[model samples]
Target: MSAYTTRQDLPGSLPAAASSALRLGALASDERFEVTVRVRPRAAPPDLAASAATLALKPAQQQQLSREEYAAAFGADPADLAKVADFARHFGLVVLDSSSARRSVFLSGTADQFAAAFGTQIEQVEHAGGVGRAVAAPLSVPSEVGDIVEGVFGLSDAPVARPHLQQLPEAQAAAGASFTPPQLAKLYNFPTGVDGSGQCIAIIELGGGFRTTDISNYFKGLHLPVPKVKSISVDGGKNHPTTANSADGEVMLDIEVAAGVAPKALICVYFAPNTDKGFLDAITAALHDKVNQPSVISISWGAAEKFWTPQALSSYDAAFQSAATLGVTVCCAAGDAGSGDENPDQGQPDGLAHVDFPAASPHVLACGGTRLKANGSSIASETVWNDDPLRSASGGGVSDFFDLPAYQNGAGVPASANPGGRVGRGVPDVAGDADPNTGYQVLVDGRRLVFGGTSAVAPLWAGLVALMNQKLGHHVGFLNPLLYGAAVGSGATHDITVGDIGAYQAGAGWDACTGWGSPNGAKLLQVLGS
Candidate 1:
């Protein structure tokens, strides 16, 4: 076999039409660019899907393994990484850092050096966010190095996912009876006695920051313990809050909700830039963080599947798969828009139903939204979230990229949609209270704000998973198989049999709008504990 292989074709997300030259004027040859080389795993567990399914039915203890054990079983080969580093040095690039598992090799060099090394143009591209630099074409490397480099990220610094948090206006009439986090937990029958002690919930953020004082004051008012929060920066991103945007709403809401539900659980927030490199790096850092060793991670940011390249999707999904092997549960918000998931301003269609990525990825739990009404702690009624005229609702639909996983084989996932004959993965796997009319109250940068989106649902489920891990005495890694299995027919979840989000309607068993429905905490704990 030839020692080299060409890089895979770039996704449609980075179209040829995006080739307008950046306005930065003549590029300096000495200007350096940082890039991450993703190395392919030496060997993938051939039966990984089956193994995850089996483990989902068994206790967490049965499949749990230490970081060292996981790395030995599935990380990239050391020899392959050495070849990549040598190639970087051969082209006068500096090898900044290489992960212990050799999965990610970070390198830096001038645009001249990179252009010479990869045989690609180094230029900035114009995007909706602003002009950012990127490789104008597919990168090619020496045969020896190309054989192992799965993909090269950070080459094109395009804007990443947007926070799914939606701020509701102050004047909107309070529809459902408002409830604090604790009160909401009670209404859902969350297990008592386990306050998520001894567990760390990792929260991934692309932008925004959280203030300690706000977290302290809010929790104090509720008479709950102020959860310990830690910040870990990735890819040069920081925890800076600016007055220009409401992005901070996402940062604070994630922490407040998870902490409120699991007061004693340590919360570690990983802050990164809003770019493809930053997003993927943040997730990889969180998944492999030995210091935090979070058993559960909550991500409230995502873009529609159509916006991601095939290469980007595969790389990101691989990270989630690795998390499953390490016994970590990841919860991602489906999206805030209805089935279309379109951004008219971005030239995307308004009528086509598209699901969000990460959420749409079968490995992570795709959490949708719902409007819940309660009469003094007893559930009054709940329905799929659809606040029409306003044009906001929970995101649910079949994916155009991924196929249905084995776990969803017979859970009533449909095989057709508005873009008929397109059979793919159905999101979400579960849902939570996310309607702005029935939204969670959060304090962002000192302002009391009401926000709703599938965003809040991710952290809500993360807290529940943290509590379950604490109660069960182990982590519950990948949840879909179990969710589609034993946890389905059992009394663990509430089936939302009302309303429609757009292309899909809520029904008895499973539907795109609500998945297997929202969590019924107490019953869920009992079933999973056994």
Candidate 2:
């Protein structure tokens, strides 16, 4: 379902800045040729079939690794092997597995390397049937360029399992959620005096089509000011709606939430096909939008950590930085998988470590998941929220490949104590409601689906940031360095003190489950307001 375009003329590196002319996502100034690589699936064994998390090969497969026949050929485990496996698994490659071998792997390095890995000859690389160039950065933060940032703190006090979102009575439910109580409402010192009139937020999506009719209906129900929304395109062209998922719902929720919090802001939605090429192109196009140029951009779609190459990661960091330069804050989903995505690429679950990306990249703010306990209509509490194990949970952990950026020098994130010696990056700097069961209700075309995922967290937080921007009349560009410093102890954030996300247990102060807990809307306004 994806294509890889090969570039023979260019080096095996992506540009710190883009030069492609053919735009797919919307930001392309040049038309670039891409080779298309069709994504296909392979079979895996029974026990190993759905279980994508087996660390060493399965007992039966030991011969495959031990035999000099295979080991010698593949090398002492290809250096890139770890990277490739990590990348593939992160992208749900395993889910595509049949009932035989393992999943097919997609290699992003040199052709010879891919051919060796897949045991195939290099035909033309496939290009994502896309139309936009992937933008790298919006602001250039040379100093923070090389380091991995710190993120995600846990809250152990919110309800882990709760009631159904669909069955909730329409009369009791309000257009949007509100926080009132001890922690969340307290720290969420929302700057009541703030207004987002001069600000704009950009939403990037694939596969979901949202209609103006739905928008009118939604706001009318909420009784909020009808937002000024503009649609842009890349390959797909102009105003349109694609498909729906937690990611799409989350994007819409954030837009509405931000508008609700800061009514004066304008919203721009950039819809692209949800392919790699389309994803990249959409972002590029969104960046180029001169009219409604977003002061903030929120992306909720991505694969596992290693799916992207260093060049790709760098490109994204650069893109976010570019946005930072423009006073834009980029927020991303940490992932629905737990500490490690249980063999995300494979269908069967395993207890291994996996992280979601571009969230893992030091540049963007990684958003996590949480559950809120409320009475009548007010948020009673918010805590680290997640589904049962091997199911889905907020993604939080340390990175293996990246070194801690200097900005992380004193942040509480410890040097990862894992076998992988690299300084790790803590995911999900901040979190919001991502529990699918207790998910948000949204409008797509005409119907409403209550969906949730880490996908929802990113945009929700981004919208909050927009509201904050409206309040301060200033953008909080690249907030990691500031948020992670000592803000955890500050009342700026509500300490979600309940519940647990499968793997990690939430507790008193910052835990891995719910990072620094959920926001206290009114309080957040006050803190940011000041």
TM-scores of the models, in the order given: 0.93, 0.64
Cα lDDT listed for each candidate:
0.81, 0.50
Best by lDDT: 1
Clashes of each: 1, 89
Q: What's model 1's overall lDDT?
A: 0.81
Q: Give the per-residue lDDT of model 1 (tens digit) for 358-434.
A: 79887899999999999887789999998861257898889888887777887888765764667778899999998
Error of 1 at 509 (Å): 0.8
**How many residue pairs in model 1 have overlapping backbones?**
1
- What does each candidate score in C-alpha RMSD? 2.8, 17.3
Candidate 2 has a TM-score of 0.64
TM-score of 1: 0.93
**In model 1, what is the error at residue 165, expressed in angstroms?**
0.8
